[model samples]
Target: MSKYDPLSGHLRRQREDELELTFAEIERILGAMLPKGAARQQWWANTTDPHTSHVQRKSWRGAGYDAFLIAGKERVRFKRVR
Candidate 1:
């Protein structure tokens, strides 16, 4: 299983339509630090194309959510999309 599976599981367990979390909070859920790339807004794209190398996309997208970066802030907003 991918390390990000924990994040997917966490999202799956949420009852809110939308959830906002600081990068630190996500790291806590993953039990590891996010890669440096995570600081880039484009890195948080909601792209779900199977061929994409952005594996983290599967965590939220597979959990029926889409990820949106909170510009200038180290936070991400996850909105249920499915």
Candidate 2:
């Protein structure tokens, strides 16, 4: 299962198309601690389905959302696209 599945369901229930969440919040949704430097680099590179490859760098696309960083990478904002 993709780490973003839980978060996808949460956002869908909220009826929100665009939302931002802190790294801590993301961890809670994923039910695991994020890898080091998760708030940096290309963590927002959501293009491919994460379940397709456990080592893939793709972000939220597996959950049907496009993601990007905000507040200088302090938070992530995901926009529903599917």
Best candidate (score: lDDT)? 1
Residues 1-82, candidate 1, lDDT per residue (tens digit)? 8989999999999999999999999999999999998989888897868888777998888999999999889999999995
Model 2 quality (TM-score): 0.67
Q: Over 4 Å off in model 1, which ranges?
A: none
**In angstroms, how far off is 36's CA in candidate 1?**
0.8
Q: Report the poorest 10 consecutive residues by lDDT, candidate 1.
A: 46-55
Q: Candidate 1 at 13: error in angstroms? A: 0.4
